[model samples]
Target: MPRTKPGVGKGVLHPGAGVGKFEVRRFHPDPDLAPFVEHLWTVRWDLGDAPPFVQRTLPDPAVHIVFERDRSEIVGVVRGRFERVLVGAGRVFSAKLHPGGLAWLGAEDASRLTNRRVAVDALFAGVDVAAREAAILGAASEEAMAVELQAFLRSVAPRASAEAARA
Candidate 1:
Protein backbone atom coordinates (compact mmCIF):
# COMPACT_ATOMS: atom_id res chain seq x y z
CA MET A 1 0.00 0.00 0.00
CA PRO A 2 1.12 3.52 -0.59
CA ARG A 3 2.42 5.38 2.49
CA THR A 4 0.24 8.36 1.65
CA LYS A 5 -3.55 8.56 1.76
CA PRO A 6 -5.97 6.70 -0.42
CA GLY A 7 -8.21 8.50 -2.98
CA VAL A 8 -5.52 10.91 -4.01
CA GLY A 9 -6.22 11.54 -7.68
CA LYS A 10 -3.55 9.71 -9.60
CA GLY A 11 -0.64 12.06 -9.03
CA VAL A 12 1.77 12.23 -11.90
CA LEU A 13 5.41 12.74 -11.05
CA HIS A 14 6.25 14.33 -14.35
CA PRO A 15 3.39 15.83 -16.34
CA GLY A 16 4.80 15.54 -19.83
CA ALA A 17 6.37 12.15 -19.28
CA GLY A 18 2.83 10.92 -18.60
CA VAL A 19 3.64 7.94 -16.33
CA GLY A 20 6.00 6.50 -13.79
CA LYS A 21 8.51 8.26 -11.54
CA PHE A 22 8.07 11.91 -10.74
CA GLU A 23 11.06 14.22 -10.74
CA VAL A 24 12.31 15.31 -7.37
CA ARG A 25 14.73 18.23 -7.08
CA ARG A 26 16.78 18.54 -3.95
CA PHE A 27 17.23 22.06 -2.56
CA HIS A 28 20.07 23.13 -0.34
CA PRO A 29 21.94 26.36 0.30
CA ASP A 30 25.37 24.73 0.19
CA PRO A 31 26.74 22.42 -2.48
CA ASP A 32 25.39 19.50 -0.53
CA LEU A 33 21.68 19.61 -1.49
CA ALA A 34 20.43 21.82 -4.30
CA PRO A 35 22.69 22.11 -7.30
CA PHE A 36 19.89 23.29 -9.60
CA VAL A 37 19.16 26.28 -7.42
CA GLU A 38 22.74 27.38 -7.88
CA HIS A 39 22.58 26.89 -11.63
CA LEU A 40 19.49 29.06 -11.94
CA TRP A 41 21.02 31.96 -10.07
CA THR A 42 24.13 31.86 -12.22
CA VAL A 43 22.12 33.10 -15.20
CA ARG A 44 20.17 35.84 -13.44
CA TRP A 45 17.82 36.65 -10.52
CA ASP A 46 14.11 36.12 -10.74
CA LEU A 47 11.28 36.29 -8.20
CA GLY A 48 10.91 32.65 -9.13
CA ASP A 49 13.88 31.94 -6.89
CA ALA A 50 11.87 32.06 -3.67
CA PRO A 51 10.43 28.57 -3.91
CA PRO A 52 13.87 27.01 -4.00
CA PHE A 53 14.88 29.00 -0.96
CA VAL A 54 11.80 27.78 0.89
CA GLN A 55 12.44 24.24 -0.22
CA ARG A 56 16.04 24.35 0.97
CA THR A 57 15.00 25.48 4.42
CA LEU A 58 12.39 22.87 5.26
CA PRO A 59 13.33 20.29 7.90
CA ASP A 60 12.47 17.13 5.95
CA PRO A 61 15.38 15.17 4.49
CA ALA A 62 13.40 13.02 2.04
CA VAL A 63 11.78 15.90 0.22
CA HIS A 64 13.23 16.98 -3.09
CA ILE A 65 10.50 18.62 -5.09
CA VAL A 66 6.83 19.61 -5.04
CA PHE A 67 5.19 18.42 -8.23
CA GLU A 68 2.03 20.16 -9.39
CA ARG A 69 0.85 17.87 -12.11
CA ASP A 70 -1.97 19.98 -13.45
CA ARG A 71 0.31 22.91 -14.00
CA SER A 72 3.45 20.87 -14.47
CA GLU A 73 5.39 22.90 -11.98
CA ILE A 74 7.87 21.74 -9.39
CA VAL A 75 9.01 23.46 -6.21
CA GLY A 76 11.71 22.44 -3.80
CA VAL A 77 10.77 21.69 -0.20
CA VAL A 78 12.14 19.97 2.90
CA ARG A 79 10.15 18.19 5.54
CA GLY A 80 9.72 19.76 8.95
CA ARG A 81 11.04 18.14 12.13
CA PHE A 82 9.70 18.32 15.62
CA GLU A 83 12.38 18.66 18.27
CA ARG A 84 11.92 17.11 21.68
CA VAL A 85 14.25 18.17 24.43
CA LEU A 86 14.96 15.40 26.81
CA VAL A 87 15.89 17.06 30.05
CA GLY A 88 17.15 15.58 33.27
CA ALA A 89 17.97 16.53 36.84
CA GLY A 90 18.89 20.23 36.96
CA ARG A 91 20.17 20.27 33.41
CA VAL A 92 19.02 20.64 29.85
CA PHE A 93 20.05 17.76 27.58
CA SER A 94 19.30 15.50 24.68
CA ALA A 95 17.56 17.12 21.76
CA LYS A 96 16.19 14.68 19.22
CA LEU A 97 14.92 15.67 15.79
CA HIS A 98 11.81 13.64 15.08
CA PRO A 99 10.53 13.46 11.51
CA GLY A 100 7.01 14.83 11.79
CA GLY A 101 6.28 12.94 8.53
CA LEU A 102 3.60 15.36 7.42
CA ALA A 103 6.14 17.45 5.57
CA TRP A 104 5.86 15.34 2.49
CA LEU A 105 2.38 16.55 1.66
CA GLY A 106 2.27 19.05 -1.16
CA ALA A 107 1.77 22.74 -0.49
CA GLU A 108 -2.05 22.71 -0.74
CA ASP A 109 -2.41 19.90 1.77
CA ALA A 110 0.24 21.14 4.15
CA SER A 111 -0.94 24.73 4.34
CA ARG A 112 -4.19 23.49 5.79
CA LEU A 113 -2.20 21.55 8.40
CA THR A 114 -1.00 24.59 10.28
CA ASN A 115 -4.19 24.66 12.29
CA ARG A 116 -3.20 23.58 15.81
CA ARG A 117 -6.32 21.51 16.04
CA VAL A 118 -5.07 19.40 13.18
CA ALA A 119 -1.53 19.18 14.53
CA VAL A 120 -2.61 17.78 17.90
CA ASP A 121 -4.71 15.21 16.13
CA ALA A 122 -1.84 14.07 13.93
CA LEU A 123 0.55 13.92 16.88
CA PHE A 124 -1.63 11.32 18.55
CA ALA A 125 -1.20 9.06 15.56
CA GLY A 126 2.52 9.65 14.94
CA VAL A 127 3.95 9.87 18.45
CA ASP A 128 3.80 6.13 18.98
CA VAL A 129 5.86 5.56 15.83
CA ALA A 130 8.61 7.77 17.20
CA ALA A 131 8.44 6.45 20.76
CA ARG A 132 8.61 2.85 19.63
CA GLU A 133 11.60 3.54 17.41
CA ALA A 134 13.40 5.31 20.22
CA ALA A 135 12.72 2.47 22.62
CA ILE A 136 13.83 -0.14 20.13
CA LEU A 137 17.06 1.75 19.52
CA GLY A 138 17.63 2.11 23.26
CA ALA A 139 17.97 5.86 23.18
CA ALA A 140 17.51 5.86 26.90
CA SER A 141 16.29 9.03 28.54
CA GLU A 142 19.22 10.62 30.32
CA GLU A 143 20.44 13.81 32.01
CA ALA A 144 23.54 14.47 29.97
CA MET A 145 24.86 14.48 26.42
CA ALA A 146 22.60 16.55 24.21
CA VAL A 147 21.97 15.23 20.73
CA GLU A 148 20.31 17.30 18.05
CA LEU A 149 19.23 16.10 14.62
CA GLN A 150 17.62 18.35 12.01
CA ALA A 151 15.01 16.94 9.65
CA PHE A 152 11.38 17.28 8.59
CA LEU A 153 8.09 15.50 8.08
CA ARG A 154 4.70 16.25 6.53
CA SER A 155 2.85 16.18 9.81
CA VAL A 156 2.90 14.44 13.17
CA ALA A 157 -0.34 12.56 12.47
CA PRO A 158 -0.65 8.81 12.37
CA ARG A 159 -2.30 9.07 8.97
CA ALA A 160 -3.24 11.65 6.38
CA SER A 161 -6.77 11.89 7.66
CA ALA A 162 -7.58 15.37 6.43
CA GLU A 163 -5.92 14.89 3.10
CA ALA A 164 -7.82 11.65 2.76
CA ALA A 165 -11.09 13.35 3.57
CA ARG A 166 -10.52 15.96 0.91
CA ALA A 167 -9.96 13.30 -1.66
Candidate 2:
Protein backbone atom coordinates (compact mmCIF):
# COMPACT_ATOMS: atom_id res chain seq x y z
CA MET A 1 0.00 0.00 0.00
CA PRO A 2 1.12 3.58 -0.71
CA ARG A 3 1.72 5.31 2.60
CA THR A 4 3.03 8.50 0.98
CA LYS A 5 0.95 10.92 -1.01
CA PRO A 6 1.31 11.34 -4.77
CA GLY A 7 3.33 14.52 -4.94
CA VAL A 8 2.44 17.93 -6.31
CA GLY A 9 -0.16 18.22 -9.10
CA LYS A 10 -1.01 14.56 -9.25
CA GLY A 11 -3.21 13.64 -6.31
CA VAL A 12 -3.11 17.19 -5.03
CA LEU A 13 -5.05 19.64 -7.18
CA HIS A 14 -5.19 22.65 -4.96
CA PRO A 15 -4.71 26.08 -6.52
CA GLY A 16 -1.20 27.43 -5.90
CA ALA A 17 -0.64 23.92 -4.59
CA GLY A 18 1.69 24.27 -1.62
CA VAL A 19 1.95 28.01 -1.81
CA GLY A 20 0.07 30.66 0.22
CA LYS A 21 -1.30 30.72 3.76
CA PHE A 22 -2.99 27.34 3.39
CA GLU A 23 -0.78 24.68 4.87
CA VAL A 24 -0.88 20.91 5.24
CA ARG A 25 1.10 19.36 8.07
CA ARG A 26 1.65 15.66 8.61
CA PHE A 27 2.99 14.15 11.81
CA HIS A 28 4.58 10.75 11.97
CA PRO A 29 2.60 8.02 13.66
CA ASP A 30 3.67 6.60 16.99
CA PRO A 31 6.31 3.90 16.56
CA ASP A 32 4.10 1.09 17.81
CA LEU A 33 1.07 2.37 15.94
CA ALA A 34 2.89 2.69 12.62
CA PRO A 35 1.57 -0.65 11.36
CA PHE A 36 -2.03 0.52 11.47
CA VAL A 37 -1.88 4.26 11.06
CA GLU A 38 -0.17 5.99 8.16
CA HIS A 39 -0.17 9.49 9.61
CA LEU A 40 -2.00 12.15 11.55
CA TRP A 41 -2.36 15.29 9.47
CA THR A 42 -3.81 18.75 9.85
CA VAL A 43 -4.78 21.40 7.35
CA ARG A 44 -4.80 25.00 8.46
CA TRP A 45 -5.85 27.99 6.43
CA ASP A 46 -6.26 31.71 6.94
CA LEU A 47 -7.74 33.80 4.16
CA GLY A 48 -8.34 37.02 6.02
CA ASP A 49 -10.26 39.10 3.43
CA ALA A 50 -9.50 36.96 0.42
CA PRO A 51 -11.98 34.78 -1.43
CA PRO A 52 -12.59 31.23 -0.39
CA PHE A 53 -10.14 28.69 -1.73
CA VAL A 54 -11.07 25.37 -3.27
CA GLN A 55 -8.86 22.36 -2.63
CA ARG A 56 -9.20 19.01 -4.28
CA THR A 57 -7.40 15.72 -4.01
CA LEU A 58 -7.52 12.23 -5.46
CA PRO A 59 -8.19 10.11 -2.39
CA ASP A 60 -6.75 6.68 -1.88
CA PRO A 61 -8.39 3.48 -0.72
CA ALA A 62 -8.33 3.87 3.07
CA VAL A 63 -10.32 4.96 6.06
CA HIS A 64 -10.02 8.42 7.59
CA ILE A 65 -11.12 9.68 10.99
CA VAL A 66 -11.75 13.38 10.49
CA PHE A 67 -12.12 15.90 13.31
CA GLU A 68 -13.44 19.32 12.58
CA ARG A 69 -14.54 22.03 14.94
CA ASP A 70 -18.15 20.99 14.94
CA ARG A 71 -18.12 17.35 13.86
CA SER A 72 -16.09 14.19 13.75
CA GLU A 73 -16.58 11.36 11.27
CA ILE A 74 -15.19 8.16 9.88
CA VAL A 75 -14.93 8.14 6.11
CA GLY A 76 -14.44 5.01 4.06
CA VAL A 77 -12.54 4.68 0.82
CA VAL A 78 -13.27 7.33 -1.76
CA ARG A 79 -13.31 6.10 -5.33
CA GLY A 80 -13.33 9.64 -6.64
CA ARG A 81 -11.77 13.02 -6.09
CA PHE A 82 -12.25 14.81 -2.77
CA GLU A 83 -13.04 18.49 -2.66
CA ARG A 84 -13.38 21.06 0.08
CA VAL A 85 -13.95 24.77 0.36
CA LEU A 86 -11.75 26.80 2.69
CA VAL A 87 -12.80 30.12 4.09
CA GLY A 88 -11.72 32.46 6.86
CA ALA A 89 -9.40 30.70 9.30
CA GLY A 90 -9.72 27.12 10.44
CA ARG A 91 -7.93 23.86 11.00
CA VAL A 92 -8.87 20.17 10.76
CA PHE A 93 -7.05 17.23 12.30
CA SER A 94 -7.44 13.68 11.00
CA ALA A 95 -5.98 10.21 11.19
CA LYS A 96 -5.49 8.15 8.03
CA LEU A 97 -5.84 4.45 8.74
CA HIS A 98 -4.08 1.79 6.72
CA PRO A 99 -6.07 -0.74 4.71
CA GLY A 100 -4.78 -3.51 6.94
CA GLY A 101 -6.15 -1.70 9.95
CA LEU A 102 -9.69 -1.14 8.73
CA ALA A 103 -11.36 -3.18 11.45
CA TRP A 104 -9.92 -0.80 14.07
CA LEU A 105 -11.14 -2.00 17.47
CA GLY A 106 -14.53 -2.96 16.10
CA ALA A 107 -15.77 -6.16 14.49
CA GLU A 108 -17.26 -4.38 11.46
CA ASP A 109 -15.92 -5.35 8.07
CA ALA A 110 -14.09 -2.65 6.20
CA SER A 111 -15.71 -3.67 2.91
CA ARG A 112 -19.07 -2.69 4.33
CA LEU A 113 -17.96 0.90 4.61
CA THR A 114 -16.98 1.50 1.00
CA ASN A 115 -17.83 4.97 -0.18
CA ARG A 116 -19.60 5.72 3.08
CA ARG A 117 -19.32 8.39 5.74
CA VAL A 118 -20.44 7.66 9.29
CA ALA A 119 -20.31 9.36 12.66
CA VAL A 120 -17.27 8.58 14.81
CA ASP A 121 -19.69 7.08 17.32
CA ALA A 122 -20.48 4.36 14.79
CA LEU A 123 -16.96 3.04 15.14
CA PHE A 124 -15.86 4.01 18.65
CA ALA A 125 -17.98 3.14 21.66
CA GLY A 126 -17.90 4.84 25.08
CA VAL A 127 -16.13 7.83 23.58
CA ASP A 128 -17.13 11.31 24.63
CA VAL A 129 -17.49 12.80 21.17
CA ALA A 130 -17.71 16.39 22.29
CA ALA A 131 -14.92 16.06 24.81
CA ARG A 132 -12.47 14.39 22.46
CA GLU A 133 -13.26 16.65 19.58
CA ALA A 134 -12.82 19.60 21.87
CA ALA A 135 -9.51 18.37 23.20
CA ILE A 136 -8.10 17.89 19.73
CA LEU A 137 -9.57 20.78 17.76
CA GLY A 138 -9.34 23.13 20.66
CA ALA A 139 -5.64 22.50 21.08
CA ALA A 140 -3.38 25.54 20.95
CA SER A 141 -1.05 24.05 18.36
CA GLU A 142 -1.04 21.41 15.66
CA GLU A 143 1.49 19.31 17.54
CA ALA A 144 -0.77 19.29 20.58
CA MET A 145 -3.69 18.26 18.44
CA ALA A 146 -1.70 15.44 16.91
CA VAL A 147 -0.72 14.27 20.37
CA GLU A 148 -4.34 14.22 21.46
CA LEU A 149 -5.32 12.32 18.33
CA GLN A 150 -2.65 9.70 18.94
CA ALA A 151 -3.75 9.28 22.52
CA PHE A 152 -7.32 8.86 21.38
CA LEU A 153 -6.34 6.25 18.83
CA ARG A 154 -4.13 4.40 21.27
CA SER A 155 -7.10 4.11 23.57
CA VAL A 156 -9.21 2.29 21.00
CA ALA A 157 -7.12 1.09 18.05
CA PRO A 158 -6.72 -2.60 17.40
CA ARG A 159 -3.87 -4.77 16.25
CA ALA A 160 -3.83 -5.81 12.59
CA SER A 161 -4.52 -9.43 11.83
CA ALA A 162 -2.09 -11.38 9.68
CA GLU A 163 -4.67 -11.92 6.96
CA ALA A 164 -5.80 -8.31 7.10
CA ALA A 165 -2.20 -7.17 6.63
CA ARG A 166 -2.16 -8.64 3.15
CA ALA A 167 -5.45 -7.09 2.15
Candidate 3:
Protein backbone atom coordinates (compact mmCIF):
# COMPACT_ATOMS: atom_id res chain seq x y z
CA MET A 1 0.00 0.00 0.00
CA PRO A 2 1.20 3.50 -0.69
CA ARG A 3 2.02 5.76 2.22
CA THR A 4 -0.53 8.47 3.04
CA LYS A 5 -0.19 11.83 4.74
CA PRO A 6 -1.42 12.11 8.31
CA GLY A 7 -4.37 14.34 9.24
CA VAL A 8 -4.44 15.99 5.86
CA GLY A 9 -7.68 17.73 6.68
CA LYS A 10 -9.94 15.07 5.20
CA GLY A 11 -12.62 16.02 7.73
CA VAL A 12 -12.02 12.67 9.28
CA LEU A 13 -12.88 13.13 12.91
CA HIS A 14 -11.36 9.76 13.61
CA PRO A 15 -8.21 8.78 11.70
CA GLY A 16 -7.65 5.04 11.50
CA ALA A 17 -11.31 4.15 11.30
CA GLY A 18 -11.82 6.63 8.48
CA VAL A 19 -13.39 9.00 10.96
CA GLY A 20 -16.01 11.20 9.26
CA LYS A 21 -18.92 9.23 10.65
CA PHE A 22 -21.14 10.73 8.01
CA GLU A 23 -21.43 10.98 4.27
CA VAL A 24 -22.76 13.87 2.23
CA ARG A 25 -25.01 12.93 -0.65
CA ARG A 26 -26.18 15.11 -3.47
CA PHE A 27 -29.88 14.24 -3.09
CA HIS A 28 -31.27 11.13 -1.53
CA PRO A 29 -34.87 10.19 -1.06
CA ASP A 30 -36.02 11.03 2.44
CA PRO A 31 -39.44 11.77 3.86
CA ASP A 32 -37.96 14.17 6.36
CA LEU A 33 -35.60 15.94 3.97
CA ALA A 34 -38.38 17.91 2.27
CA PRO A 35 -39.61 19.24 5.56
CA PHE A 36 -36.07 19.90 6.67
CA VAL A 37 -35.35 21.74 3.48
CA GLU A 38 -38.66 23.57 3.87
CA HIS A 39 -37.87 24.67 7.38
CA LEU A 40 -34.47 25.75 6.19
CA TRP A 41 -35.89 27.69 3.24
CA THR A 42 -38.89 29.17 5.05
CA VAL A 43 -37.10 29.93 8.25
CA ARG A 44 -33.64 29.93 6.71
CA TRP A 45 -33.32 31.04 3.14
CA ASP A 46 -29.61 31.58 3.48
CA LEU A 47 -29.08 27.86 3.81
CA GLY A 48 -30.61 27.11 0.43
CA ASP A 49 -28.78 29.93 -1.30
CA ALA A 50 -25.71 27.77 -1.87
CA PRO A 51 -26.26 26.75 -5.48
CA PRO A 52 -26.58 30.32 -6.67
CA PHE A 53 -22.92 30.73 -5.98
CA VAL A 54 -22.19 28.23 -8.73
CA GLN A 55 -24.79 29.86 -10.95
CA ARG A 56 -23.47 33.39 -10.87
CA THR A 57 -19.90 32.12 -10.58
CA LEU A 58 -19.57 34.55 -7.68
CA PRO A 59 -15.99 33.43 -7.04
CA ASP A 60 -17.54 31.94 -3.93
CA PRO A 61 -21.01 30.49 -4.03
CA ALA A 62 -22.81 28.57 -1.34
CA VAL A 63 -23.83 25.03 -2.21
CA HIS A 64 -26.41 22.80 -0.57
CA ILE A 65 -26.33 19.04 -0.19
CA VAL A 66 -28.40 16.64 1.85
CA PHE A 67 -26.15 14.79 4.26
CA GLU A 68 -26.48 11.06 4.83
CA ARG A 69 -24.34 8.92 7.06
CA ASP A 70 -24.13 5.31 8.29
CA ARG A 71 -24.83 4.05 4.78
CA SER A 72 -28.52 4.97 4.95
CA GLU A 73 -28.96 6.97 8.09
CA ILE A 74 -30.15 10.52 7.58
CA VAL A 75 -27.88 12.85 9.41
CA GLY A 76 -28.36 16.56 9.94
CA VAL A 77 -27.74 18.86 6.98
CA VAL A 78 -25.49 21.86 6.43
CA ARG A 79 -24.43 24.37 3.77
CA GLY A 80 -21.00 25.57 2.66
CA ARG A 81 -19.76 28.27 0.34
CA PHE A 82 -16.29 29.42 -0.56
CA GLU A 83 -14.88 32.79 -1.55
CA ARG A 84 -11.55 33.60 -3.14
CA VAL A 85 -9.51 36.63 -3.99
CA LEU A 86 -7.35 37.03 -7.04
CA VAL A 87 -4.33 39.09 -6.15
CA GLY A 88 -2.36 40.39 -9.02
CA ALA A 89 -0.50 43.57 -9.83
CA GLY A 90 -1.13 45.14 -6.44
CA ARG A 91 -4.88 44.72 -7.03
CA VAL A 92 -6.99 42.15 -5.24
CA PHE A 93 -10.30 40.87 -6.58
CA SER A 94 -12.82 39.07 -4.47
CA ALA A 95 -12.79 35.67 -6.10
CA LYS A 96 -15.07 34.07 -3.58
CA LEU A 97 -16.94 36.04 -0.93
CA HIS A 98 -18.79 33.64 1.33
CA PRO A 99 -17.20 30.36 2.27
CA GLY A 100 -18.84 28.21 4.95
CA GLY A 101 -22.33 29.46 4.37
CA LEU A 102 -24.90 29.72 7.15
CA ALA A 103 -25.81 26.43 8.83
CA TRP A 104 -29.23 26.28 10.54
CA LEU A 105 -30.53 23.22 8.79
CA GLY A 106 -32.25 21.33 11.62
CA ALA A 107 -30.91 22.52 14.90
CA GLU A 108 -34.39 22.61 16.43
CA ASP A 109 -34.82 18.94 15.61
CA ALA A 110 -32.76 16.94 18.04
CA SER A 111 -33.65 13.84 16.09
CA ARG A 112 -31.32 15.18 13.45
CA LEU A 113 -28.45 16.40 15.59
CA THR A 114 -27.05 15.82 19.07
CA ASN A 115 -25.71 12.37 19.87
CA ARG A 116 -25.94 11.63 16.19
CA ARG A 117 -22.25 11.90 15.48
CA VAL A 118 -22.85 11.10 11.84
CA ALA A 119 -25.09 14.12 11.43
CA VAL A 120 -22.60 16.43 13.02
CA ASP A 121 -19.81 15.03 10.88
CA ALA A 122 -21.81 15.67 7.77
CA LEU A 123 -22.27 19.27 8.79
CA PHE A 124 -18.60 19.71 9.48
CA ALA A 125 -17.81 18.03 6.21
CA GLY A 126 -19.67 20.86 4.61
CA VAL A 127 -17.41 23.20 6.51
CA ASP A 128 -14.38 21.28 5.33
CA VAL A 129 -15.53 21.69 1.77
CA ALA A 130 -15.58 25.43 2.15
CA ALA A 131 -12.19 25.43 3.77
CA ARG A 132 -10.68 23.17 1.16
CA GLU A 133 -12.06 25.30 -1.62
CA ALA A 134 -10.34 28.28 -0.14
CA ALA A 135 -7.10 26.36 0.14
CA ILE A 136 -7.34 25.10 -3.41
CA LEU A 137 -8.09 28.49 -4.90
CA GLY A 138 -5.12 29.97 -3.11
CA ALA A 139 -7.59 32.24 -1.37
CA ALA A 140 -8.37 32.87 2.26
CA SER A 141 -11.63 32.31 4.07
CA GLU A 142 -11.41 35.93 5.20
CA GLU A 143 -14.65 36.29 7.21
CA ALA A 144 -16.87 33.69 5.59
CA MET A 145 -17.37 31.82 8.82
CA ALA A 146 -18.39 34.98 10.65
CA VAL A 147 -20.66 36.00 7.81
CA GLU A 148 -22.34 32.60 7.90
CA LEU A 149 -23.16 32.96 11.58
CA GLN A 150 -24.57 36.43 11.05
CA ALA A 151 -26.72 35.13 8.23
CA PHE A 152 -28.06 32.44 10.52
CA LEU A 153 -29.05 35.07 13.08
CA ARG A 154 -30.73 37.17 10.43
CA SER A 155 -32.65 34.19 9.13
CA VAL A 156 -34.19 33.45 12.50
CA ALA A 157 -35.17 37.09 13.00
CA PRO A 158 -38.39 36.54 11.08
CA ARG A 159 -39.42 33.84 13.51
CA ALA A 160 -39.59 36.33 16.36
CA SER A 161 -42.33 38.31 14.66
CA ALA A 162 -44.30 35.21 13.88
CA GLU A 163 -44.03 33.99 17.43
CA ALA A 164 -45.05 37.37 18.83
CA ALA A 165 -48.09 37.48 16.57
CA ARG A 166 -49.12 34.02 17.78
CA ALA A 167 -48.91 35.16 21.35
lDDT string, candidate 2, 134-163, tens digits? 999988777788878888877775543443
Candidate 1 residue spans exceeding 4 A from truth = 1-108, 115-130, 133-167
Q: lDDT tens string, model 3, 11-77?
A: 2233343222211111111222222221111000122222221111111122232211112122222
User: What C-alpha lDDT values do all the predictions have?
Assistant: 0.23, 0.76, 0.25
TM-score of each: 0.19, 0.82, 0.19
What lDDT score goes with residue 29 in model 3? 16
TM-score of 1: 0.19
In model 3, what is the error at residue 112, expressed in angstroms? 7.0
Q: State the lDDT of candidate 1 residue by residue for 1-167, as single tens digits.
A: 10111221222222343122112211112221112111111001122322221111223232122111121112223334332121221111111111222342322343343412222214334334333333322324221111111111223222345544443
Worst 10 residues of 3 by lDDT: 89-98
| Count of backbone collisions in candidate 3 | 11
Error of 1 at 23 (Å): 39
lDDT of 3: 0.25
Candidate 2 versus the native: TM-score? Answer: 0.82
| Best-first order by lDDT | 2, 3, 1
